[model samples]
Target: MKAFCEEYNIKGGIWNDSNFRAILEATMYLPVTDKDYRKWLNFFFENCSYNQLLFNRIQLNEGTENKMFSDRDLVVQRLEAKLLRYTDAKECETEYCLKLTSVFERLDLLFNNSWKKDVLDLITRLPHEQYNQDEINKKLSFIYSNEDCDDVLVQIKELLGLYDFETAKSENKSEIRELLKYPHYYKVLVITGTTGSGKTFFVNRYIKYCLEKLKIRDISIIPYVFDISKVVSDSNLEQLLIHEMADLLGKSVQSLEDASKLLSYLPIKICFVIENIHLIIDEKSKWNSLISCINRFSRYEEFKWLLTINGYEYYALEDISNFLQRYCIEKNSLLNISKKRLAIFQHAVNMDELNKEWHVVETILQKTLSGRMSNTYVDVNKGITTPLEALYFRECIEGEEWVSSPSTYYEFIKKIFDWKANKLAECNSTTVQSTVLVIVDCVIEKLNCVIKDSELNKSDLSCLRSVQLLSSTITICKENFSVSYGFQQISYRIRVFPYWAAIMVKNRFRSKEFKVESITGYPAELKEWLIPCYIFYNAQNENALLSLFPALKKASLLEYALFCAQRDSSVFSKALYNFIIKNVDYIKSSKRCYSVFYFVFYCPLRISQKFKLFTSIAGKVKEFNLLNLYSRVFKSVVHTSKKLKQLKKNMLELAPCDVLDINYINGYETGEVFMHLSNNEEKSFDIVINDIIAYIREHESILEIIKNGNNSSFFDFFIRKCMENYLKSKKKI
Candidate 1:
């Protein structure tokens, strides 16, 4: 055992203790005489703690120290008698009976007739020992005898199942009882909001307040925070309440059901605060069922139900309005002034956080009151003038100023009454439509011009133009429209397909596949140009494309070449030729477009070798087609295709005016022209090579790159040659 521990690198003296016990148990359980077993037991007893030895002491009442053992001996005797009766029934096999008897004998020695002896005796006496009957009986007897046995068993079972009890308690458990003090007045208090509005946080805080501040003695009165989100089907509301209660209390489900069954008899007062009641509303006929349950419990003065949801209007409870009215009347709960009830038009508005600007709020209130007054023709000189009366009176007074310093609440009330009386005199006067159309029309016209001049791509400009057009058309139609109808119409249009399309074009480029020829005069070879042009059209408009046409054209050629090179060498060459051929007529018509063409041919020559090989050939073919078509327009034109063919024909035609050696060509005039063409072609190839290098560097593992036999060798050789050349140039031998 020592060697085994050393070989496994096991550390700590504690591990040795376990090993020693295991070895001792093995020796005792071996097929040996009782004397040998006793010897094995003695070895453990000699080294064991004094408490362990005392616990195992079998000689009951032999000394004062063995008093516990004496009591255990009596318990064991009772258990053994019970077991003997079961064994006499012949429910167990002889072998199992023998084994059980042996177990009891071992217990007699090990426990020294302690409290555990009875447990062992009960185990031995179980009827069908061969069929695990003894094990079941022992478990039953142990649970029945111990007061906290069920809880302990549950904890052990949870631990075996890997449930984290500490985490569950911290996350889910909450207690609420403080609200009971105002139970009659605040019975139907609701916490309503959208998801992530901190509804759960508020509920948890309320629960904590109840537990700590209220110091409620009756745990049963504590609120059971139920998550109705889990109630997918029409579950018994009573059963669900009990299940949630059990979860909160950390009690078994069966125990909870039993408690629930006896709830009517138990004098337990529970406040249920259900979250996500919308889920319950989804279950068939559950709304009325839940309402019935709440009403039944509400009859008990102590029972309270606090239901929360995102919106109240969504609830389809039968007689809900009447129920709410009755509850509010009975509970004396104050209903909050809803957004709609307050006649506030705006759902949300941005305001400077640091500054208090109540203009919008005041305006809304004033307008609502004035509209009501105009419609009713009521004399504002009422006995008790409300805030609504004051607003109406203010509107009627107009230029005439009425002033009064109301220091006290009563004085303030008197002034309001006086204002209402004045407004009543002028009540049946007139109603005016607020016309802010001229300013809106001017803004729309300015936006249209700005959008047009911004040179946005067609898509973006189209969207902006659509929005402007729609807004103008709607404004014209709504010249005498009601404010509410106008607002609704505008909102509806904004959400409609045409307006949505405009928004898509203005913001994101249209993702739908469409043919280039259908929209643009640009050829397919100029896809690179057309795409960005389209993006600009979607983002800005046509004005933007015209302004950046030269740069767009150059970019298109370069991009097209790079794409072709990457995909297929032959395809890239053909595409490059096609681009030049298609644009030959345009180039002939406009001399300014020649520079763009020159740049396209220049990029391939200056690019990296791998890209250069493909682009150079393509650029030559493209240049040949252009020069051949426009030979008459040039003074000293070089037909480079014939020279390039000749260079290819001659194995050692050094410095030939071919695509490969276009960069090396000399002369102030010819060199300038050649450089311009070579640069664009080289740039196109450079882009391709750079992209490949970036991809390889990012994704290919260094180890794999280095291990790649031929590629690695070639790269290494190139590096060495470059370094040698650099050294030679520096004269560093």
Candidate 2:
């Protein structure tokens, strides 16, 4: 083989694609394996007829019964003797011709017993057709199996989209039991759910079920499960999967036919599991390719199927029976799991001795936290939406310390950042740092949906995927900035802000950029952290480094930060206050000092976080009486937060009156407009318009609402009255 390879200029005696080495090594799928690949290659390259090669394989096994020519060598020896005996050529020809004619007459007897042409073709060719075993038997056998019962139950209700808890729970009686029982009633089981709903986790649960029920450990029921999302872009998804399967099984599978042959040789049942099959649905060719591949694999008795398609793809997959193999069409032939069944699965996999029904979350909190209760936020009445989040809720956000410091959210996110990195097979890569800057930029720009750039590689995209996986309200997939996913989403969605805010602030103080050169879509999904991104940007330049950081030019920027701090956890609030104090010189010198200080004092978290940003501001600028100014803003916030006014004498005597000691349940400045209206003596149209302008322009929150094309009813009423007053004035003129 080496000599022929060298003659043919074939290097290393191997094929071009190195991944095929495993394929070449597999004997179950093809006649030739790694051992014979070189020999076959050498034979094909040789300048000789195929007859010699064909004879070499079967030469030893052929013509054993015939006595005249028991082998090719024996026949050759007989012919040589005839030539050696003759001296004259004419006499030799005449004797040999008569003898050969008599030999041919005898050779005709062996023709009936020789090697069949089709059997040899099976070794060297891919056949166009396979099932032709006397038509009567094929039709009768199929009819017999089809008519065995009026109805056949192959799957649980969850898989069929019935999703009734009781119906799915009854799967233990026969449905689940029949999974490993041969022959399988049906092969394919497709499951679906929303993203982050623990669809993939079910595969593991099912595996455990099979192990516990079958009293076996080989896991051969469906050993090779693949996520089809990765390769859905490829046109030849079927062949790609075949190659993947061949590598896994160490078989040189050439095609679906080769895979079928491979399955035929395996002792245990083999099921092909393709996850996220709906990814290929939009591309008709790829979809047909995938469906055809499954049906082809279905020709073999052992080739069962397991498919998982998410709910987003179900619209395309509805009436999927139109595209499935004839054998898979039955009401109970599919298996899926609902939230209830997932709970059953959760119970089955709880793995905690503390509670048989639920212990994973209990174990997570106990192991990770120092002094957290076992069921801190583990609400048993309202069952799990997803076990991972439920476990996370128990460990991170549900505890007493969850809101006091954002460190828990940071730590949670850091694990996810690295978790995604590890899952992408790029563990501890610098991509995490780069993705932070990318995400921060999008948040600052208020961009929804990442503008996917060509440069963003797999690792960067995986980080974004991690962000999306972190929460449901990530803005990268959001359409309207005005729309909301509820207060909890707004409050906890941007747990990343404080962590990145600290990192960027620290980096800015050191005069550096945090791992950003070029990135595609920033983690735009978590766009609620717009305040932190702006704060980071405000501190970004070396020019500003000498000044100890730039002051935020827009008071709206400062107001937005305060809004986030007031509404959410104190992590971001504390970070922003610290950044401001560190750069107090910039704030003292800026034109918007009063505006910034007003919001800082108005937003309860600033004072509540125990930071004296105003004290530092007062030290730098002595022109304004900072204490008196802070007292006014503090009183306004406190007085406005109340439903009724307190007497000056009573309020003064009620507390020590320290500006920093004020407690306020700060929210949107809804009462600020009413306060302005009440303070003004004039109820005339001109005065009301001035009050409205002052209220909208001076107040950032009201201004932002109006700027965003949204108007409050009170603001709209003022505008309508102003119009009526202007027309009346015009008539008087």
Per-model TM-score on C-alpha atoms: 0.24, 0.35
Report the number of the highest-lDDT candidate: 2
Winning candidate number (TM-score): 2
Instruction: Please give, for residues 1-733, the per-residue lDDT of candidate 1 as tens digits.
Output: 4543332232122223223322333333322222343454465455543665443442222242233223323433333332232122212223423433443233222211112222222222323324554554445444334223224334323222222223333322121111111112223445543322334444554454334322322122335565564443334766676665554433354543354333322223345777645544434476667766665444333355656543321234323754453332221112112333321111111111101122322342344344331211112232212223234334444542121111111222334334433432332322210111222222233322111122222222222222222121122234464574443121111111112222223333343443232323333322322333343233223333333333435434333222222112233333444454445333322222333232333323212221223222334434444443222212122223223223222211112123322221211222233333434455443453354345336544432433563332322332343344435645963
Stretches of candidate 2 exceeding 4 Å from the true structure: 1-139, 142-185, 194-196, 208-220, 226-267, 276-284, 310-316, 319-321, 324-386, 389-408, 417-733
Candidate 2's TM-score reads: 0.35
Q: Candidate 2, clashing residue pairs? A: 23-252, 155-332, 158-336, 159-335, 159-336, 438-522, 439-523, 475-525, 476-525
- The candidate 2 region of ten consecutive residues with least summed lDDT is 109-118
